[model samples]
Target chain A: MLYTFSEVLEKVNNEVKDLKFERKPYSLFEPIEYILEIGGKRVRPVLATMAYNLYKADIEKTIPIALAIEIFHNFTLLHDDLMDRADKRRGKPTVHIKWNDNTAVLSGDAMLIEAYREIAKSPKEALPEILNLFTDTATEICCGQQLDMEFEQRLNVTTDEYLEMIRLKTAVLLACSLKCGAMAANAPESDADALYDFGINIGLAFQLMDDLLDVYGDPATFGKRIGGDILCNKKTYLQITALKSPETGKEMQDWINKEVFDEQEKIDAVTGLYNKLNLKGLSEEMIESYYQKGLSCLNKVQVDDNRKRELRNLAESLLTRKS
Target chain B: MLYTFSEVLEKVNNEVKDLKFERKPYSLFEPIEYILEIGGKRVRPVLATMAYNLYKADIEKTIPIALAIEIFHNFTLLHDDLMDRADKRRGKPTVHIKWNDNTAVLSGDAMLIEAYREIAKSPKEALPEILNLFTDTATEICCGQQLDMEFEQRLNVTTDEYLEMIRLKTAVLLACSLKCGAMAANAPESDADALYDFGINIGLAFQLMDDLLDVYGDPATFGKRIGGDILCNKKTYLQITALKSPETGKEMQDWINKEVFDEQEKIDAVTGLYNKLNLKGLSEEMIESYYQKGLSCLNKVQVDDNRKRELRNLAESLLTRKS
Candidate 1:
C-alpha cells in the first residue's frame, strides 16, 4: 500500500502531464504547458506524498493536492524568472524568453488560479485548513521574493537575514506541503506540526546545500551553468560566510567592490576568496546542523520508525543529491 | 439599523485605510499602499455590503469580506496596468508607473494572497462557500483577461464573444461580491443566487457604459483621457458593433486599418463613422437593456421593497453617472 519515493514522484509526474489546459488561448496556456513539461525534481509533491504515506496508504487520495503544490511552485518560478531576468530554466528557455513578459505574467497568474482550484478539490472537511495554510505559505513566499529583490540592492545582508529570506522563499512551501499532506490523511495535530518542523529543517538544509552546490558542483552533473551565483553576485551562504569571515573578509569585500572586471575573473576571484576562507567547510557544517535538527524533528513525530523510513531516506537523498 | 450605500462606502474606505501592511519591506508593501490609496469608487465592496444589508443589518460583521473584495479589485488593476502598459489609473500614476514593473507584479501577487487571507477570516461557517466562490471568480477574471489579450490580436471578434469576454473579465467579480455578501449573512441560496444574477446584469451595463463614456463623455468629468480606448484600438462593444454593421462596416474597417494618422483626427474619423452608423443609440439601447434586466433581477429577490431600496437607488445612480 505504501509507495516508494520514486513511485510517488512518478504519480506526481503523471498527474502533472494530465493537467488540463485549453489550447484555444495558445498564448496563455502554451507557456503553462511548456513550463510544466520541463519538470523539476517534483520535490515538493514528493515530500507531501511521502508525509501522507507515513499516515495513510492511499497515495491516490493526495495526488491532486500534491499536484497543487507542484503547480504553485512552478507559478512562482514563472514570475521569478521575470524578476530575475533569468533566460534559461531546466536547460530550456525561460517562459518570458520563450514567449514574452506579458504572456509569462498572465500565464503565471492563471497557473496560480489553477493551483487553488486543485486545492479546493480536497475533501470538504480538510478544505478550510488546507486553504488557510496554503494562503499563508503563499504570502510568505511573496515576502521572501520581495526580500530577495531588496537584498540585491544592498551590500550588508547578514547571514541571519539571508537565512530568513531563503526560508520564506524556498523552505515554507516545502514545510506546508508536508504538513498539508499529513492533514490530508487526517493525521493528529501534533504529528502534523512535527512534520512541518521537520520539513522546515530539511528545507533549510536543502537550500543551504544548494548554495554550496552552485559554486562547488561539477558543471555536467549540476545541470546548470556553474559560477552563475558568483557572476551575478547573488548573496548565497558562501558569499555571506566569506563576507563575515575575519580572515578573508577584506579581500572578499575588494572583489565585491570592484566595478570593472571580466565575468569569469570575478567568479574565479570570488571562488578563490571563498576557498581561502574555508566557506565550503562552513557551509557543510551549517547544512549538517540543519539536517541533524531535521532528523530530531522527525524523531518527534509519533509515527513508527519504520513508517518514517521512506521520509528519512528521501530527505537524505535530497541532501546528498549530485543534481 | 441598515447602512445606506454611502455609509457602507465610508466603512469600506475606513477599513481599507486600517489594513496592516508591514512597513519594513517598503518596496513590496509601499506599492500596495500606493495603489489602494489612489482608490477607485470601491464599487465591488459597496455592492457587497448592500447585498449583505438586504438580509441583515449587521454591517460590521461583513466589513472584512468587503475589504477582501476591494483589495482583490485593486490587485487586478495593479497587474492590468502592467499588461495593458497603461501609465495612469484613477487620475494618478499606475502602480507600475509609480514604482516599476517588477514592483507591480510582486506586490500584486502579495495583494492577492492578502485577499485570500481576508477571505479566510470570515466566520467559520461561511468560510468554505466564500472561498469556493472567491476562487472560482478569481479564476474567471484571469480567464477573461487572457481572452481580452487574445481578442486584441484579432479583428473578427463577434458581439457574443465580446460579451462573454466582458462577463468573465468584469461581470463575474461583481456577481461574486454580492453572492458572497449574502452568504456571509446566511441568506437563503435562492436569494444569494438572485443577488448574483442582479450583479452580473449590473456589471455588464456598467462596463458597456464605460465603453460609451470613453468616446463621448466629457474628459473633465470622466477623470481620464477621452477617446483613449479608440486611440488604442481596444475592441469594445461599440467598435465591434460598428465593424459588424453592414451600413458602415467598410469605413469603420478603413479607420481601423489605417497605419498612421493624427490622434485627434483618428478620434474624429472614428467618431464620425460611429455617428454615421448610429452607434451611440445602439450602445445606449444595449446599456438600457442590461440595466432593465438588472432591475428585474433585483425585483425577483424576496426581500421587501423597503429593504431593496438602497440597492435600487445605487444601481440607478451608477447607470446615469456622467463619469
Candidate 2:
C-alpha cells in the first residue's frame, strides 16, 4: 500500500543518484560531490514525486522537475554550510571544511545554475506555470533563511513569528513540490491547489515534530544528540512557547539569561522543566492538530480511496519515523 | 565606420544572453542589485553579440541569450571578488565587501541561477544548441578560474604555459560569448565554427594588449596604475616573452626568482630591460599575427561586406586602444 507507484521518480532519483564526481583538471566538482553524497533523506524530491503521483499516472514526466527541486535544495545546503561554518553534515565533512570557502561558494553557484538547467528541460507544456511556482517558492525559502539568520541575533522572537519564518523557509518548498508535480501531471487546477495546501500543513507538522524531537527524542533514534537545540539556544517552538507561558515564564528566562551553566546542564534542566509543564505534550497535540489538517486536506482531493489511503499511510509513516 | 565597431557585436549579443536570476527572498536581492548597478563595459556581451551578428540578421531577437552571458559574467566577478578579498570593482565596493560574505555568496548563487532562467526562456527555436554552448562555456570558465587560482602557487610557469592559462582564464568566455551568439542566431554551422575561431584569436590579441597596457599605457586612459601586474608578480606575456628571449632570458628568470623587490624600481628596471630586448616589439608582432588570423577566420563567414567590415573595424580599434 506504500506508494511504490513512482518507479519513474525512483529512476530519476537514481539517475542523479550518487553520480561519480569524475574529477577534472583543477576540479571544484569533487568537494560538491562529497557534500551531495553525504546522505540526505532527499525529502524535497520525494515530496515532489508523491505530490505529482496524486494527480497523474505518468509520474516519470515530472522527473526533471523533481531533479530541479533536489538540486536547488542541495545548493542551499552548500551555501548554508559555509555560513554556519559547519564542519560536518550527515557524518561527512562540509564542502567548505573539506575544500575551502571559495570552492564551496563557486561549486554551490554551479550547482544552483545546474538546477535551472534541469527546470528548463521540463515538458514545455508545463514550463511557465511550473517555473513561476518554483521561482516564487525559492524566493520564499530565501526569505525564511534570512529570518532564521536574523533570529539568532534577536532577544525577542515569538513562537508565532518562528512559525511564520519556518512556514516560508521550509514548508513552501515542500508545498510547491507537490503543486509542481500536480501541474506536471495535468491534474485539475483545484486538485493541485488542495494538494499544495495539504503538503504545507504536513510540512508544518513535520517541522514542529522536529522541534519536539530535539528536546525529547532518544539520541540513538534521532542519530544526533537530543537537546542539541537548547545547547545552541535556538528559538524553537518548545523554548518560545515555554518563554510565553504564564506559570513558569520568567524563571525560564532567568535560567536562559544565566551565562548558560554547563551546555548539557542547561539543556537537561530546561527540558526537564518542559516535561514538568507538559510542554512536550502540548507540542505533540499541536503537531497532531496540523496532521489532522493535512489529512482533512487530503480527504478533499478526488483520488480513489485506495490511493488516498496510501497517501495517508505515507504521511503517517513520516510521523512514525524515529530518526 | 563607427570607431568602436564592437557595437555591432554588442547589438547582437543578446541572442544568447541569459539573465533573470532565480528569485531568492527580497533580503538576499539587495546586494545583487547593488553590484549589478555598478557599471562595466560589458565587453563579453558585446563580443558575443558581435560574433553572433556576423552570422544572422535576426540576432537582435536573442536578447535573453545576451542577458544570460552578462549575468553569468557578473556572477563570476561577484564570487571572484570574495575569493580575491577585493573591496571594489568598477569604482564601487564589491558585494561581499559592501554587505557580508554570506549575502554575497547567496546572492551570487541566485544570480547564476538567474542566468540559466534567462537561458531557459530563449525562444524555443534557439534553445537546444544555445543551452549546450552556454553549459560548455560556463564549465570552461570555471576551469579557467581554477587554473588562475592554481597559477598563484606555481613558480616555473613558462611562456607557452602562461599563454594557455590566460587563454582559458580571460579569453575563453569572450570566445564563448561569440560562439553562444552564433548558436542563438541559428547561423549556418560553418559560420558558427569560423566565428568561434575568430573569437578565440581576437581574445588572445585583446588579452595581450591588456597586458601591454598594464605596463606601458598612459595613466589617464588606462584608469588604473600601469605595472600593477608586474608589482603583483603576475606571470604575463611580457615577462614570458622576455624570459624566452636569448639576450634577456636569464636576467628575466633571475628577476622573477626573487620573491620581493621595490615596486617603482622593479617596474622601471623591467620595462627598461623589455625595451632593450625589443620584447614589446615582439609582442606587437605576435598580436598582429593573431589579429590577421582572426581576420582570415572572419573572411570565411559568408556575410555582407558592410557587417563584416564593421566587425573588422572593431577588432582594429581594440588593437589601437591606449587602455
TM-score of chain B of each: 0.97, 0.87
Fraction of native A-B contacts kept, per candidate? 0.66, 0.26
Q: Compose the digit string of candidate 2's lDDT tens values, residues B1-323.
A: 22234445445333323323344446677666666667576676676666666655565555666677788888889998898788888778898888888888777766775676666666666676677678767766776677677766765567687777677767777777777777777778888888888888988899899898898899888988888877776778787677678888787777767777787888898888789977788889989998999999989887776777767776788888887
Question: Top model by DockQ, which number?
Answer: 1
DockQ of 1: 0.64
Q: For candidate 2 chain B, which ten residues in a row score worst on lDDT?
A: B12-21
TM-score of chain A of each: 0.97, 0.92
TM-scores of the candidates are 0.95, 0.86
lDDT digits (tens) for residues A104-223 of candidate 2: 877876676566667767776777678778877776776787788877777578977899888987789888988888888787888888889888888898898888888888788898
Candidate 2 TM-score over all chains jointly:
0.86
Q: Clashing residue pairs in candidate 1, if any?
A: none
> Candidate 1's residue-wise lDDT over A75-104, tens digit each?
999999998999998889999998898888
